[model samples]
Target: MTLSRALAIAGFVVAGLALLAVEWAARRPDSRVPTLGAVVALVMRYDVGGLPVGRLAILLFWFWLGWHFLAR
Candidate 1:
């Protein structure tokens, strides 16, 4: 594999681990370390008047990206 492709795969693995850790933290009621997901929850407008389309699409993109890298 090329250097760039290898770097990308490594990055993806790190990101996936970080995201999973954040998600785990966010689920904990007594956790002190804040998660990126929590900050995004405050800032992002995932829904206007309560629709989930925008958030769902973004999630799909992330999933596709992870799959693409791992499939390489």
Candidate 2:
């Protein structure tokens, strides 16, 4: 296989492993790893002058990511 294709496959494998790890951690009650909802709540708590800057920033990031990588 070409080097780029191999690298892409490796990247996907790593991402999948990371997702699995997160799922496992979130499922374990005694695990120190914070759940996705907790992380989002923490981020959403940040604000600037009564505006939810963190939430807005996350929304913008998701929009940009979807537009660039997921859109056909």
Output the number of the TM-score-best candidate.
2
lDDT of each: 0.78, 0.89
Model 1 quality (TM-score): 0.48
What is candidate 2's lDDT per residue for 1-72, written digit by digit as tens? Answer: 999989988998999899888978888988888887888889989998999998998899899979977999
> lDDT value for candidate 2?
0.89
TM-score of 2: 0.71
- Best prediction by lDDT: 2
Residue clash pairs of candidate 2? none
Model 2: residue 65 alpha-carbon error in angstroms:
2.2
TM per candidate: 0.48, 0.71
RMSD of 1: 4.8
lDDT of 1 by residue, 1-72 (tens): 999989988998999998898779777898887776666565455677787766777788789978975877
> lDDT score of model 1?
0.78
RMSD of each: 4.8, 2.3
